[model samples]
Target: MVMGFREFCDYEWFSFTMENYVVHILFSKSEPGPLLEGKSKYVELGGVYSAQLHQAHTSVGQTHIHVYARNNQLFAMNHDGSAHDRSHGSQIPNKVAQAITQKFPNFTLPKDNYIESAPSGIVNAFGHQLLLG
Candidate 1:
């Protein structure tokens, strides 16, 4: 199955390819989507484990996407190693928080999680469903 997002939607979307293309979409519940226009970037989100992700999150201005699980809940957050890491919903807009929080099972801030940032700005985040300790 495939999904889509709006071009101007507040939520960010990402794509990765293996046998088929899968898009990681961040969305809100209030806004219905026919489909979201996702990113054309190549990323390798691990399926085996989540511990492999760790990065330099010290600079807020530095662009990066972080994905991790805590209390059995999946989360994706932007920028890291900054003072703002503690404040949930500090950076995200009201509409964005509501959309993603309701749309996806993943939500909340992350730290020292699997981080990714290509040549382009890092926005959307992906996490492996199976947790491995």
Candidate 2:
């Protein structure tokens, strides 16, 4: 089903183990629709975000990593944990990487490892097209 950003976040937060990795994928621009106040942010193309899973919370948690889109490029800002370096490059711990890879082979390490622009549709790394609605 096509999901709104909040619905997507809820699914990721509650449906997985704490050990599973999560990346908050943001598009460059907001899709045309009504966005819930304070819950969703409009994104630009090339905006990137990464976060290390801390204490698992089904409803709430700390926000980490904020990369702004500049000239269609993402530049990392100050982040909360060591998983990301100043370069905005990912430093995903080995164990977390392995678990994610095992479950989603299309999953790429270092959220920015690929050079392609983000796809407009919801598809995982394995090219599995997700029906967002």
Query: Which one wins on lDDT?
Result: 1
For candidate 1, the lDDT comes to 0.34
lDDT tens digits, residue span 88-115, model 2: 3334445444544553344344443321
Superposed on all Cα atoms, the candidates' RMSDs to the truth, in angstroms, are 17.6, 17.7
lDDT of residue 41 for candidate 2: 46
Worst 10-residue lDDT window for candidate 2 reads: 114-123
Task: Give one digit per residue, the lDDT tens place, for model 1 in 10-109.
Answer: 4555444446666575544344553422332322233321211223232223333333232221333533422223333234334433443453333333
Query: 60 in model 2: Cα distance from truth in Å?
Result: 29
Best by TM-score: 2
Give all TM-scores, in the order shown: 0.20, 0.23
